[model samples]
Target: MTMRAVRLVPALIILLVALTCASLMIGSVSLSWIDLIKGFIRQDQTAALIIYDIRLPRTLLALSVGFVLGLSGAALQGLLRNPLADPALFGAPQAAALGAVLVLYTGTVEALSFALPVAALGGALLSVLLVLAVAGRVAGVTTLILAGLAVASLAAALTSIVINLSANPFAVTEIVFWLLGSFEDRSFRHVAMAAPFMVIGSLLLLRAGEPLRALTLGEETAESLGLSLVRERILIVLGVACALGGAVSVSGAIGFVGLVAPHLVRDAVKGDPKAVLLPAALVGAALTLSADMLARLVPAPTELKVGALTALMGVPFFLAIIARRRGAIAADAS
Candidate 1:
């Protein structure tokens, strides 16, 4: 690693740790450092239950999901060679949510069942493939974005239809929660279910860094450098599908971390897709944890969905990206 990166990484780790502690502290009950230290050292049951049973899982899920999303986004932007590319932008998580909805409609399948994540993975894979297909063999950034929007809308519509047709009100509620995406009420069981996917998927995306870096120079040059386009595509798609599907299965469809996280670290990595994954993951973890914290702190009878908050904040960034894309397209045309 470069000296700059080595220096940056420790700082990022410290930031993530600080944000995690903040997440642990800023909840409905408002925990103190003393409570946490006592919880750990003296085994205080009340503090332990709040930290261990409640906040910890949500915090961990935020971190894991954020890391996976960040890794996937950076890898995807590399694959598509588009600054705006992300799993959420491409509707991958919506598809995964659809898969979960199909399995758990009316809570028909247990939320903890293996079938939930498997179906979500299948859905995510299908969505990504369709996006690729719709974008065509040589699609522009605008075309890819439009295609993803269409696919996402369609998937969301189907998901709503499933919810509307449900005879069970509980099932409708479950499906709606999955659609909105939040970390509330998750448990260690969720952490366990999603951990394997996060680990494996992170590895797959991290491994693709070399090929992704090579591809930045275009396919022909990458191929000449012994990069297999097919292999790279498979790793990107499957890595995203597994990690994102698992995450959505547990936490619904938290969007925009993939969009926001990688971009935050792009300059730090000197625009190297290969080097951006770790930094992006760290930033993503911090972002998600912070957002989840806000979701809790929002003063309403019920907290806001983290997904909605991200959408609200990220729309401006999305529009800026579109403006940039339009300028690039205009320049190309000229």
Candidate 2:
């Protein structure tokens, strides 16, 4: 690693820690540093109750979900050699959301804690399988993207149908808000359910970095280096399915973090997708935590949706990247 890269990692880690503390303290109650210490140290029961029961899970959820999204995004981009690639682009989040909604629609969301995430995981796995099946073992990146788009569209359509057919207005409302994404009112159960899968997925994606570096030389070159394209593709797809599925199952459909996070750190890492993964994850966590804090702290009748806030922050970045790429293309053509 270069000197700048070595320095960047520590800086990002510090930023994440600061943001995490801020997330825990910036809720409706507005805890101070002493209050935070007292709460964790058990010197204050009320503060402890508030921190542990309400904020801890929410903070952890944001951190884990953001980390997974960023890492998966970086990994997917490496796999496809497309900077715009995101786990959500493959319909994993949409499919997972649909699965959770199915549980909600069937009135089983309340019955069991594990049911929602499990169903969502199942949906995500199915989407990955469908994409792989349609794209075929030897299909190119473009084909994989097209297959993913089809699955995403179908998942979205099915979710809409469920909403339309629901008899309970309240249930429909819950589902709608969930689709918008937030860490509000989440609990330790959610943390438990999602964290393990995210960790597993992250491990899988981290392994792709070396192979992805080889892939930068082109598929045939990578093959000459003895990197199995087929196996690599499967690793990334399954990793995304697990990580993104777990994230969406709990937080709903938070977007843009994956797409934006890698870009934030890409330059610092000298455009190495492998190097981008960890820093992107840290940036993603910081972004999500910051957004979640704003959602709570912003003066409103109700808390803003974190998903909406992220989109507001991310959309302009997305457009700017596209315009820059367009300019580059035009220049190349010229």
Highest TM-score model number: 1
CA-lDDT, candidates in order:
0.84, 0.83
TM values, all candidates: 0.96, 0.91
Q: Candidate 1 on 179-247: residue-level lDDT in tens?
A: 787999889999999888778888888888889899888877888998888878888899989988888
Which has the greatest lDDT?
1
Model 2: what TM-score?
0.91
Question: How many pairs collide in each candidate, listed in order?
Answer: 1, 0
Show the lowest summed lDDT stretch of 10 residues, model 2.
325-334
Span of 10 residues, lowest total lDDT, candidate 1? 325-334
Query: Tens digit of lDDT per residue, candidate 2, span 1-334?
Result: 6677788989999998999898888877989999999999889998899899999999999998999888888987887677767766678788989998898787766723667777787788788778768876444545766788999999999999999988888877888888889999989988988887888888888888898898887778899999997788788778887887788888998888998999988899998867888888888888888889989999998779998998898889877876778765454344
Question: How does model 1 fare in lDDT?
Answer: 0.84
